[model samples]
Target: MISRSDWLRDWQLVTRTALLILALTGTVAYAGSQVPIGKPPGESEPVPATMRGRFAGFVATLQFDNEAWTDAFVLAPDRRWFAEYARDATNIRVKDLRSGVTLRRLRTGGRKISGLAVSSDSRIVRAVDEDGKPLAWTVATGKSVSSEAEAEGINRIDHLTIHRWDNDISEPPGPTANPGQLISRFLASHGLSEQLPDLQTIEQVTTSVDGRYVAITEGYLGHLTIRDLSNSSAPVTIEWPEDWCGHYLASFAFDGHYVVLGTHGDEGDHAFTDAAAFEIKNGKAKALWHAECSVDRDAPEQISRDARFYAIGAAPNGPVVVWDLRAARRAAHFEGVYVAPIISADGSTFAVTKAASKGRRMLVLRHGKRRRLDANIEADPTGPIEDGVYALSSNGRYFAARIASATPGGKNAVGVWDTDSARQIRTIEPGGDAANSWKIAELSNTGDIILLADKSVFKAGRWIDVTEADESLLRGRSDSQLTPDNKHALIKQDLFLASFTLREIATGKTIWSLQGTPDLGFVMSFPDGRVRISPGAEKYLKLVRGFAVKPFDANAKRQFLRH
Candidate 1:
């Protein structure tokens, strides 16, 4: 089975090539305009003073770049500490989330960080290096909790590998070839699955919540090397039963007290197998329970935040089943193929999109009770992303659904529902020539909705339509710029800590741009159109052009250390 790392490598290659083309052509991928503050839809007058003040506060305090290349900002469960990795991946910083002050910065022994895991109490942190070695450090003391021998054992794997699909089709090479072998021969004659290596030394490591146990799975292998972080014992290697002929597709449960491995075999047979769960106690694992199930190869099991419950899309025309991992049994089951089953971080609620006969529906489960948020809405065959059907709020407090019309041929609308009450909080229906057929672009942590069609932000019963400011009238440009006509020039400064200015060619109108961090900065267009400053410091400024700048923030304390 193909691993996520292989897919990510392929995606990075494609993304790099696409960014090169965009940089050469001097094109802005998306507009980065701030969400506007305005009245709710259909209201002529502005919103109430208190609500307006809330909107202003929302835009100022919370500004996170969603399109950054690195997943640096990770908040601990307690929300006390936020660990941020450098853009170059050389170091990491643990910052106080409440005050936004830097606490400590530590280097990663020259190996780039591939994954990070923090404990629930926000006192311990576990960072996995690119070489699959795990480092456990105390957040309060900045001291290593792991010993040198344990770190060496974690990185002792001599080689890594990934199983190639092409190798499966190769003939057994003998007097007689079976039907499968004949098909493989035919495919090989056509020059398929050639040149790609079957395995390599690149693996992904995942850790438990308390930073005690870690499971290292190679990209192409079915065997798993489990490490006990809190103890000095040797790593334990586990594989599926020989009869299953299973390969490691992904991790089923890699958090909390138990670690479950997911395996996938041939289609229509045992598509997915949880098979067993290992309970970790005192930094040692013992076989606890064996809960086995059949699921499609594409649909892996989804676990709740606290690792108490898990949802699986059953295979071969099966129902979606919710499993109670602690009980080692099935908890609930629902009919039909539901899409995007997301559970709350606390495991208090769960959300999934269902396909109803009349139309598409969103079903939320709270305390063993199921309620359909949108029963009559039309089922959107396509989702926001390639594989995702609908977007669910991270906390499972809300979900976004595209509302199908009650009439057979009526226009569709976008609706946001509150999961607690199973009630539709807001519905955005565009009339006449308005921007209709909208998809959810973002769902903020504060339970606000942002539509992709016009960048309309819906927060606190208000509509902040930014189509005029964000969506330019230019034929090719997709950046936020106020240009009355193509003749007038739009210039921006404050790209760096230094100062810069620009003037229009025909009218000679000077435009001064203010200071913005690399995350919020914009590009500037020169008069002759030959020179242009680019946005996306990591994409254009850092990756392709090889630029590096570290701006100083006086409010944040700084400390650096070598490990």
Candidate 2:
């Protein structure tokens, strides 16, 4: 009787287990099964409802469908990165992160994107199109544009050449004992970068702000390659796509996630046909947004980014239109602002300088009211503002510019004007540099102007005459700064500080001197309680303004550096 009861219980447990297995398998079958959807096993996996690339990591590069060949490219500031094929090459395409995987690519459309900011977290991106003011899609997750199998017809001569960064040193990868350590390791890994003396023949060079990454469109659309600058010399390359018509990358930029491209060529002529925006995923670029624009060209042209606004205007002067990517259309329309519009730092207002007038050249401020501050000094017709010259500052109260006189003696003057009454306030005839050679890059109102000239930077104003040895010591060094008094300077020379000297503001004498290399460059105190020399590259520059020399308070930083 006991054995028979045990057998019945076992049978019941087996039955329950079988039921559970059947349910779980049924669910799995729905998601992944040998049978196809309403079909047989011939269809392996279900096709993605839509295919796209997601930015998965940093340091992504643009890969083109160049028949297994590779091309180097840059992202146009505000447009799509277009990749065209070589004239002799076919089968232009790129791989998924150098893997055998392929992605769906769109090769058309473009629009001016304003209010574009890289996401702080470096995930997604958002932009406003001042022209197409509609809140379309920010994430490069949607949209489809037309594309040809191979981007063939773009002109070769028109494309730009990229300067290659190469190095030849070997070392273990770790925190370096020297600045060039990484560069040395790279050279050691790759051997020597080919010396291309003829590279100069290929003009139209575009480089990153840091002069790090470079791309070239050469020989009338001939060859392209992306170099792993990690090792400057031997750039490891993943070439050509199998299926797509050899589409070589024309230009590219990063929003920290996806790589973007704007197409330009015979294939992509109309707004719907020629330009495109895409994102890089798995080492492949997937198309995002594309639009047809009134602009079209047989050759690719460069576009600038990082400006406050961008607009497409009709020939002549119909209306100045700004396209906002967020709004997806032309957002603001204004007249008189059509010329070169430079926005102030605060974003509250802007100064508009018209394209060279036939006989009239003037500068205007766009606040609530249209205000003219300077006369058309452009009447001389020699050329705008003389070569290398620039206006430093112009607030309704004070306007300064590096100007040239008609006569040779009419040298460049840092002119200041009182805009409230439009009267010349002070004309600082700070001698030096050709007409525009002097640019007032920054003014801390400490009466200092950092100026750049002939590969040399001068800290000038009434505040000149630092120690000669100190100046020589500071040569070839960047970020080392001089105190406003011309006395003490944070010296960065030959990788070490020769010394620091405190100067007399009135007579230009070293009152105190010290030695250290901890900080270098022209001294600038921030309103937020931070003191630094002109940051980074600004050290190699000379910033000229109305006040060639600004008088500063040693303790002014105690108060926030306010406007």
Candidate 3:
């Protein structure tokens, strides 16, 4: 017999208390969960499904057994099919997005597959195994291919063509003629004028050392186009040979005078089979030479400053090889699994470590002679020697290696060595609270300075805490970016909600700050008025139509400078 209003008030209070308990206990049903602000519970904490902003609700719930499952799904460009990991994580299921029907199941041969991608035609699915081996499957036939050639062959397009801008013109255009106009005319002639509104998918981009030429590879067809920054009116288009199936890498050498193309195919243990050099002559690329070589996909290929030599190899164990590009021959070969093989600009010195051996011993090859230098640094058997752990100067005069702590719970350090005398020259230790997070160690080209992430900078033979110098804006921040000119920085702090601050590096003054919007996950819109959201974003899309946030515009940088 209680009053109706009094009864409703009591019910509301009980409901609110129940929700608070559910949020704190993480019993929420969708992929989203409420997390506490401040430091994460552990170092390897997974990203929360909640979006960033005050009063912003969860945007999506990511359904996965673990964090690794976040990248195991991909949608085709045609919007017809999508590929995702099966429940077992050992197989991939290609399903039609429109009907929500499973089309085919692809076996992974017991290897866990990740990085799933669909071809442009929606006929093939490609992924990489846990061991870094490439795998592919045909959607319709449910067939699998082990060889690189067969994998690429099934995805090749027959009508792929390259269009050149300067092909019909006998002379360069006058200054009054706009380069944009010329490009527009070329596109119209090729029946691509109406398609200009669509975004062009570029797989890779490389610029010449001199910064004059830029090479762009089309994502789907492997066609290449070279554009001169000085003369944008005349772009050279190079088509891959019909026999070739895929383009692995492209690079510039000899100050933009030579263009090197790496193609993958042929039966071998490696994916990169052919490395070809092309000379730029009269606004055209003429093939100079081609060599049968294998380059590791994960290793970063090194090219000498003068473009006279190239070194390529990878970890665990390696038969590291150095190639003399000018002479078209192999210069030197070292048979051992080494860590971080590097070549000097003058092609006179090379440094690498015998990772499998004990002690901090470095192998130095100078002028065809090999010597071992004892860095006098203790090795941490538990720590893995990753890419950024070691750095060498461009001249090879100085080499830097991360010194692992001698005892457990001890701090790490950096040791610099003079390659000529094979002696440790200096040891730089992390300062303040940054010692625990010290990961990336870098050496300047001249070997006069060292940078330990964004935390510390070693200059003039002294360590300076960069975070303290920058007014501690970057303190405790995991992700931050510095402008190329070193004048400004963007610091991002993610707690319960993400926030960003643009600060002046020298003055340590905050220029602007903004709250980040929640990540709605990956969404693909189709022409047929259908939309597809990733599994992680499906539930979140129903809660919010859009976000109100200020996005950074590159064109408005000048406006920011005025502030």
Candidate 4:
């Protein structure tokens, strides 16, 4: 995932690049037509006082074509003047709301303005530059007006929040208690809130490869629980030391007998203090090994299916620590933010991007040796940099990366490569026009098939529209998601109701159906028709053949919210 800072920087870079391209091409008409300048035509009529507020609200939603970067807006206290600042441009556009005309453009002399605020009297506009320095301008004359004290008094809107117009609809009132309290009450009713007074909520839910085991964690406190879905055995809960900070990373080993947990220090600390492997046996968890490591909070971490290796690290410029769980030591440490670090099921092979390199310089590590393969993934300046664009097969014998079009107006494609020989295997390009083009969603575990966002499957060197093939099962559905393996799909029957159905993608056979309310709670279903839901949804959760639901104990409910 791209950080907010990175996303904003990329947006600015793209805007600047577009401007430079237009300048070099000598396209004055193109630039003039795209950018809004001066007063728009027919602004003589004065907006009615009654409608001025509504007009200002409408103007707040307007954006120039090149204003694609981060921006801010401030309406004067009287709503007579509006100030706008675009990160890509070095000027603030002040408009007269009453007359519906551009009043003045305040230049910042190339400094990037990040925030904007208008004075109560509508004569002065204060701004904070990217460096947090104060700047002010006169609205009437477009002259710089420096007043440190005045700038300090202004409350700036640092970043503008842009929401879809349809999202303006008011939503129903939320629960009186916080989400954490509600989750706690729900868990207590299910008899799963033992020794968990600090349990805020279910942080994450991870399932084993075969969907037989699940590992859940309490986000606030360092509590971990592993449950076996194959049998009716009591879950094994592991609680960390009271002084040890929370655990944000947890994953089940591919074999389902072991799990890995990564811990970090208190708030503001990004380093991982310790990562431990636990062996589960006889309904109990025993610590196998613990290793100290530093990993970024947003970094990627993965545990091999064989339970022999675990990889964790930060990105951009952080260490990628690959630990040998069997030996309880660090096997290899690579520096640089890797696009994706994937370990083979057997721990004999690994695929990752080259350390500190531009473009997708891929490297495959086999038997403690590295071989470089230039994937030549093109950069898409018009879009934010996406993570997980590259995927490695479980066997680590195949690699796939989403590739941009070689030329402008060309179709994007996905390239697959042979890891062993470091050779290009094939490039699969989905068919569609530019507007409705198919995007690469996921690469199959084996790297032989690719799933597109439009529910299309690419296999055997051809694209198959699964939506068309399974029309009977998907017709009139609100939303649907095909399993990673493309064998089954989870479908929602309505947009405003909680009605779901699990169906086989190939045969259109309904495996099970469920009906509930919007607040029915968290639900997770596996490709094999196994469904697991939180206690809040248990009352309405119906499964044809899956784990038995625990009866809710109303007597165990606690008043988590204080009066």
Best by TM-score: 3
Whole-model lDDT per candidate:
0.43, 0.31, 0.46, 0.48
Predicted structure 4: lDDT: 0.48
RMSD of each: 21.6, 29.2, 25.9, 27.4
* Tens-digit lDDT string for candidate 4 (398-517): 777777655477676778888778888887775453213444443544666544445554545666566543422222221343333434444433321223445553344545433322
Q: 1-563, model 1: which lDDT tens digit per residue?
A: 66896477446533433332332233324345322111111111111122122122110111221111222345566655556553334445555544333454444534566566666687766677766667766665455565233333222111111222223335554433332333234324433214213223323444433345555555544556665555545566654454443444433333334444445444434334423455556655566443233332333235553445556553222356665644535566676766546665456677666555665566788777888775455454333112222456656777766666545666766667787788888765544333354555445444666454444443333455655534222111212112222222222211112122322323334332222222223222122211122223212111000011222221110111000
Q: Model 2 misses residue 308 by how many Å?
A: 8.0
Candidate 4's C-alpha runs over 4 A off are 1-296, 337-339, 355-358, 379-388, 433-447, 468-563
Q: Candidate 3 vs candidate 4: which has greater TM-score?
A: 3
* Candidate 3: Cα lDDT at 92: 68
lDDT of 2 by residue, 395-485 (tens): 2234444545545666655555544456556555556543345455433222234444544444435334445443333332232333322
Question: In terms of lDDT, which candidate is stronger, 2 or 3?
Answer: 3
TM-score of each: 0.30, 0.31, 0.32, 0.32
Backbone clashes counted, model 1: 8
State the RMSD for candidate 1: 21.6
Off by over 4 Å in 3: 1-297, 356-360, 376-384, 405-410, 439-447, 461-563
Given candidate 2, what's the lDDT at residue 34?
31
Query: Best-fitting candidate, measured by lDDT?
Result: 4
Q: Which ranges in model 2 have alpha carbons more than 4 Å from their true place?
A: 1-337, 356-360, 377-388, 391-397, 406-408, 433-436, 443-450, 455-563
True-vs-predicted CA distance for residue 550, candidate 3, Å: 55
